[model samples]
Target: MDVADGVLVAGYRIVRRLGSGGMGTVYLAQHPRLPRWDALKVLDDRHDSDSEFHARFLREAELAARLQHPNLVAVHDRGEDHGRLWIAMQYIDGGDLAGLIRRGPQVLTVERAVRILGDAAAGLDEIHRAGLLHRDVKPANILLTTDADGSDRVLVTDFGVAHPIEDGVKQSGGVATTLAYAAPEQFGDGPVDHRADVYALGCTLYQMLTGSVPFPRTGAGSVMYAHLHEPPPRPSAANPQVPKDFDAVIATAMAKNPADRFASCGALAAAARAALTPTPRRRATRLSVAALVIILVAAAALVGVLSRTTPSQARPVRTPVSGSVDGSQWGAFAYIAQAFPDLLPGFPYGSGYEELSGCLPQDTKYNNVPLDTSLPIGTLFCLGNRDPVIDLEIVCNADRTPIQPGVALADFPEGDEAWSRPSGSGHLFWGHTTFTDTGSDLDGHTTGVLEIFFDRADRNFCRIQVVGTPTTGADLRAAWWPGAPL
Candidate 1:
């Protein structure tokens, strides 16, 4: 088909062919009015008269459109242009994960693998939450994009083969799914649900981390048999740097029985996050410092050993400032503020106080304090006592060493230095909240903290930061307490 022969559909001008697959051919298109671009998938005319295929296609489109998540590609509009069925979706500039792996180095860092799979899990969770299963989840269906801020983001696409949970009818012969990533249930009459997606995600993650499929077989039936009976080897066996916990997570996700796997995609994502945590000792060191500092300060005040200082004695905390000050309320405001322009639009801006104005209560007593009391660990805040402002930083520490403070705010810039010196707007009264390690050897603890800041009389921000620790949840709970007096 010639690219220029078709009329513009839904105001998107088709530029050129992107790629063709079993479902349809995708075209590169641009919105006539908006600056955004899109990929338009047009089903071939051969299927137009087939009612069953059309119904299935429409159902898939409806299901995909209902899902709105960061890791899922969004469908913008669907219609017929010149008697051809077409769907417009957000255009991702980057290539598929499979292509990236096939080219050059093929191996991925443990952090990169976990992060990508975690994002895909989140997307799958959203899909399952909507009562749909991505029957065809594979590396080729997962797209990778680097935001303007340089953070890697994963987008799960091509849900044309996805099955709706409520629909009892089985899809008849025609298009075949990728065997490499297909779960065993997909090969037979076993019950399929969110667990199938989990299994496929496990296979995808395995391939991504090790640069090879879990079961490499020349025949589709052989691969399916392996998925049905064999337990995949640990990724750490291939790459020593991969954590043992990750191996357990993958094994669990790829369990032969659906009941043996995580209950949902969200659970799998949470497990992946837990497995991705670095050695416990380092995490503990990050958490310990924050906990110890808070405890010591509290203890000193409780005992007669340290006198409580009046507001006059408090000093104005100085630190660099920029972007929206309201970010402080969420614990990683500074990072989000600096990262917004590159990550997303519509960032609030003004004096730090002005940016935070809407989030603050009218009552002066709680003016600068975060509205949310029970925040995720590692949130930073700005405290002022009607006089000089104090930079209140909370961070995770293990073995007494502070992990850099600030939460990983969505749509925020990603980099170690970005957390330290965020771009744009400047004032300095900085404080970082950190977690600490509690083990005898600092190797077992995980540190996580939130950061918030009050600078001069204007700019202030809050943020949450976390570092993994080897310590248990009980110890973390015991050590976690805001330093403010009750």
Candidate 2:
């Protein structure tokens, strides 16, 4: 029974068909007596003739309707039309999480990703407590919206494949799970429980952080084999911005053995929050600070083992410095500078650009450069065409202190500093350096400087100042430092 737009069903008028899939067709619907609209989903007609499928569909609707968590999508009404099952649910104006992720990994920061997944995990916990599991917990099943105060609202939708937890795992005749995010036990006729949801949530969080599924969808057979046998790579490996602790969290939640995973979805979410949380920096004696820097410098690219501690009692953990260049005194900035010419956007300026890379060794003998052991090593690169020359300086530190925007204007001729708050990429500390009589590659041109602090977890940072930059702050960030927010 195809319901057309403007058709009335059980006192609800169908505005338009929202979407359709193997499970059912969803439509924008309105209640005649109510003021607000609702999402009306009608189960496929083919299942109406099959009593078993019909019963299962009705059961799912009943179960979902009974669930009333803030994070879970609300079910407004359920009824039958021409022997077909249909449900009216709260209509969400904001698109699904899959769309947000498809935009880019930068759309969801580490903090935002954890909060979204944590909310879904809380909703999943509620479902699990009621003796049920969300069999499908992929990005497509997660809906997103913004609150009146501009805070993100995450809603878990689509309980079409929800299953009851019986004994340790629900008895299932066949697997009905998304292969890319399924647990090992979900592949075979093994007992599946809430742990399956934990595994799927882990996979979802991985995608949210790195914009790629745990296992590449090369082929169905390959994915299945990989899930069962291969250990998944850490998200931090793909996106260095991810904290090292997150690697352990993903590994634990997506363990091949269910028993090795977190105790529950709620526990999994809590672990994720802890893993991504940054350690608080405290004031220490100069000797202690020097020792800490020495330990971090010596550790070099090794993973930092983080322990969970409350904010009031938080302590510093030695974060491993991650970068391609190792121990040559020149930091990762020198390496990235070599690749900056190719990484820059190409249109009118790509064919005729000159690239020059150099670095000033940190000299305690020179008063211009600080002698403080806490200060990071720096590198400089110059790239341009005939005009609007771009000069970039990369700074790296083992410590995770926040970047200061004013620091970018230190070397240039003294000028009135105009600092702007961080924008699209939180790592950017951009501003303008006007009122200067500097004589360099840029002799007589207004200068706009941007300090881009790379991934804190990796301990990489850079200061990019474009002389005669003919673009907005947003454009400069998008073109030069794509991974600043990733």
Candidate 3:
């Protein structure tokens, strides 16, 4: 039965319908005696009539109500109104994780992504400690909002299908979890446990990092096949800005075997945190100070990577090199100038106008340029671009470290066509990337990106990526790489 606005169910006055899912419709309602509002969820007639559904709904209300954590949504009351069961929960004004992702992948930096995951993981672990498995874990069920103190508050909601951990009891039935994040055991007659939640958390983490489900497929069959047989897709492969260390983390979290997965969701979050922390920079004292090195080199058409907010306000934070080797001739910047004489040597200008440490600020509308990917690596080797809406930047190692080109290329995998050829002391790679770039003052709404990689593995290198680039594999030797030929 539909409850109109101003109608009272169990004494709580309904305001308006907030949203609806398969089981019920959630509404904003006035609390019976409190000076506040609550989210009122009423069961559908079909499910409310089922005795099994009645037990499960009661289980949801009871189990969730018993637990109290900052990250889990609180249940206040539940009762039957006109033969339909209903529940009142703390109303959250902010949106869910699915909404955050829809805003675009650019909004989810590594820091922001991990913070959200950490909150969700904490809530899941608490549930597990209370002897329950949140069988339904997905982006839509995760809520995101700001606390009254202006801090991020994430709430894990909708434990409608939570099942108790029954050891060694293998069961076969219809899948009760999201298909995209389902573990292999979930698709078979295997013993399912907390590790399944761990696997789903892995998928959720992937979505936060790359803004797409780990197994992005239109058909249920394809997603199921991927979960059951295929390997987990790397987050760094989807967004180059993501650190490569996360690849191994995602792999272990989404392992085909539940035993292979992390012991708990908290463990997975810890691994991800470790991945985000950069390894200590080499202690070699033979590198030049970047701040001292940067100056008006000359008016040149330079091309590279981009992350920008607004050109007028943002300035990149440059680190000054110290010690005797600050004047050293051996460096990534010097190597790029010698290798590509026509190509400009510089770094990236950060996005949405946020100041990035070590990133050289460049304007989006002007000839300003930012360097390579968000990876904390060597100096970027810029090519050519005059009035650029996008750019291509390749990194050159400061210590001349030998990064295996194939392994490095695997980090940026979802491309239309990826190929390589010999460049000065390295191999130059090119491909059509799958990174979807969006901005308000965009050139042409960013239909595609052309990625060019100058890999001097013995010297560690980077990809030259340009958003809003031409769709052409016709000429690799052409000046379509902004202005320079490969």
Give a tens-digit lDDT track for model 1, residues 248-327.
Answer: 88898899888898887668778877888746564457567789778768877776633455332363212222222233
lDDT of 3 at 92: 91
**Angstrom error at residue 184, model 3:** 1.6
Residue-level lDDT tens digits of model 3 in 242-317: 8889999999999998888899999999999989995544422454666323421321212221233433226332
Candidate 1 Cα outliers beyond 4 Å, as residue runs: 1-11, 32-35, 103-107, 169-176, 278-486
lDDT of each: 0.55, 0.62, 0.62
Model 2 per-residue lDDT tens digits across residues 1-486: 457779887878999766542267778888879898999888876466788777777777888888899999998878887676888888999877765554443456788998898898988998998898887787877889999999889899888778778645543665576666788888787678998999999988887777566775323455678899999779888666788889999999899998999999889889888887745452233457678887677656343323233322363212112111222222333333332333221111111122111123242232223222334444333333212235444443334354444454423332333323343222444445543454342344445555544433333343345543433333344333332222
Question: How many residue pairs clash in each candidate at the backbone level?
Answer: 90, 0, 16
The Cα error of candidate 1 at residue 118, in Å, is 1.4
Task: Kindly give the stretch of ten consecutive residues in candidate 2 with the minimal lDDT sum.
Answer: 345-354
If the candidates were sorted by their TM-score against the true structure, best first, what order would they fall in?
2, 3, 1
The Cα RMSD of model 3 versus the native structure comes to 19.8
- The TM-score of predicted model 1 comes to 0.54
